[model samples]
Target: MARQKDAFYFDGFRRSADYACQAAKLLSEVMHDFNPDQLRERMDGMHALEKAADGVRHAMMDELVTAFITPFDREDIDELGRVLDDVTDSIEGVLNRMYYDNVTDM
Candidate 1:
């Protein structure tokens, strides 16, 4: 039972990482087709993906904190969750900076 729970938690972390990667891909595509008019829409899509990733990360963290017998160190699980969230945040920061800087070219 503990192994199964650990697997489930790991799976959730993997899914969140996947979502962050997908969001980064979408941002890359948008950057390739840079246009001020479409920036908001593109950013919106990226934000949605980031939110989804964050949701999964938060769920994992909550489970880790609540579980009396986590398969791994609780701190490690929390750190991994934070890293997954930071991936999206880093991407978002780049996009936001570009938008604010008035960068019209890719």
Candidate 2:
């Protein structure tokens, strides 16, 4: 049981990292190819990635509440997840600012 719970946490951590990577790539693509016509669509895509990352973090929190065998302390695991989520948010934030501010250049 403990081992299984640990596996869940590990899987959650991995997924979070994957989301961060995807967010970074998306942000890069949007910035590299700035297009006013596609700004809305790009923002939508970034929002989706951010939302998905949030879900992963939320799941980690839910599991942490009941997890007895986390890789480290429960608070540490929770903080790690939050930090990972923040990374996605920070990446997404750039695109969001561009979209909202009507950035027309790199």
Candidate 3:
């Protein structure tokens, strides 16, 4: 199951990092396998990771809005959350394009 929404800023980042790692690993496996038929399935899995990362980011923003005392500036927190999610989103993007563009091989 998906991880619980981050309760703290550090948790959000750690969750995002985990999602990014999962995406990277999934993408690596896809490339190593080099199967066109499986591209769609791979894309689906990548998207799930990206979506999970997004959830943590969104939760982080929600917390930031209500948090009065933070370790850093609001902008920094928001930026970090965005950057963290981007790692997974970026990996998903690669798979997305490959699937849509009908890429037959690596």
The lDDT leader among the candidates is 2
- Order by lDDT, highest first: 2, 3, 1
- Tens-digit lDDT track for model 1 on 1-106? 4577788688988897898788788878877877888888887888888888888887897888778888888888888889888998888878878878887777
Error of 1 at 96 (Å): 1.5
Whose TM-score is greatest here? 2
- Write model 3 residue lDDT over 5-105, tens digit each, in one string: 33478787898999999999998999888899888878878878888888889988888898777777789989999999888888899888888898896
Query: Candidate 2, residues 2-22: lDDT per residue as tens digits?
Result: 576688888888999999999
- Scored against the true structure, residue 24 in model 2 reaches a CA lDDT of 94
Q: Specify the poorest-scoring 10-residue window by lDDT in model 3.
A: 1-10
What TM-score number comes out for model 3? 0.90
Off by over 4 Å in 1: none
Candidates 2 and 3: which is better by lDDT?
2
Q: Distance from true position, residue 64, model 3, in Å?
A: 0.3
* Backbone collision tally, model 3: 0
**What clash count goes with each model?**
0, 0, 0
Question: Which window of ten consecutive residues has the lowest lDDT sum in model 1?
Answer: 1-10
Evaluate all candidate structures by whole-model CA lDDT and list the values in order.
0.83, 0.86, 0.84
